[model samples]
Target: MKPHRHSLYRTFANAAAGVVHAFKTERNMKIHAAAALMVFIAAALLQLDLIRWLFLLLAVGLVFTAELINTAIEAVVDLVSPQVHPYARIAKDTAAGAVLVAAIVAVGIGIGVFYEPIRGWIGSLL
Candidate 1:
């Protein structure tokens, strides 16, 4: 069978819908979004250099991408194997692990980018 085709608008709308669904249903998505907001606020306050800003943006994107993929994997596993199964459990758990790894990397990037500015800001306050 030939593959189905979608209009550009439809493709974008579907992608947006997935993002909305994840944010609405996934607790982790909310936490990531909140953390991202705080990071941006701090970056603004600190006047991050362009390179640092790019790093922060990439880190945030990585976390978001990982989380979205994890959510998709969980949904597929649930649909394919609704009953409890070892393989299904493995699939879901590993997908979650990916998110954990991404979050850790993002944290490291945040610390690397923020450490100097935060330290200086604190020093100036004292």
Candidate 2:
């Protein structure tokens, strides 16, 4: 006999719940959420062009997605290897590094996109 399989809707609902749980349980997800909100505000205040906004949103999405992937990787690694192991450590570290790289790139993009406008605003006041 085969084990029961969930319906499509049930699978989707489970996936959605996992995402919500990841957001709630993961500290980095909270940080990403905050950064995303900041980027949205900056986009509005800076009056970004459509193309700039698109790039900004894409960068933000990349960071968040990378973070989620990293969290999932860490969780699975922990589940599989509860005991301390060098390879498990390496796997988690590599996943974290990916997130870090994505975050750094996102920051670079944000600075590049917003710096000139922000500098001009300050220059006008000063």
Best by lDDT: 1
User: For each candidate, what is the lDDT?
Assistant: 0.97, 0.90
Tens-digit lDDT track of model 1 for 34-117: 999999999999999999999999999999999999999999999999999999999999999999999999999999999999
Indicate which candidate wins on TM-score.
1
Give per-model CA RMSD.
Answer: 0.8, 2.1
C-alpha lDDT of candidate 1 relative to the true structure: 0.97
Cα TM-score per model: 0.97, 0.87
Clashes of 1: 0
Error of 2 at 33 (Å): 1.0
Q: What is the C-alpha lDDT profile of model 2 across 63-86, one tens digit per residue?
A: 888888898899999999999999
Candidate 2 wrong stretches, greater than 4 Å: 1-8
**Clashing residue pairs, backbone N/CA/C < 3 A, model 2:** none
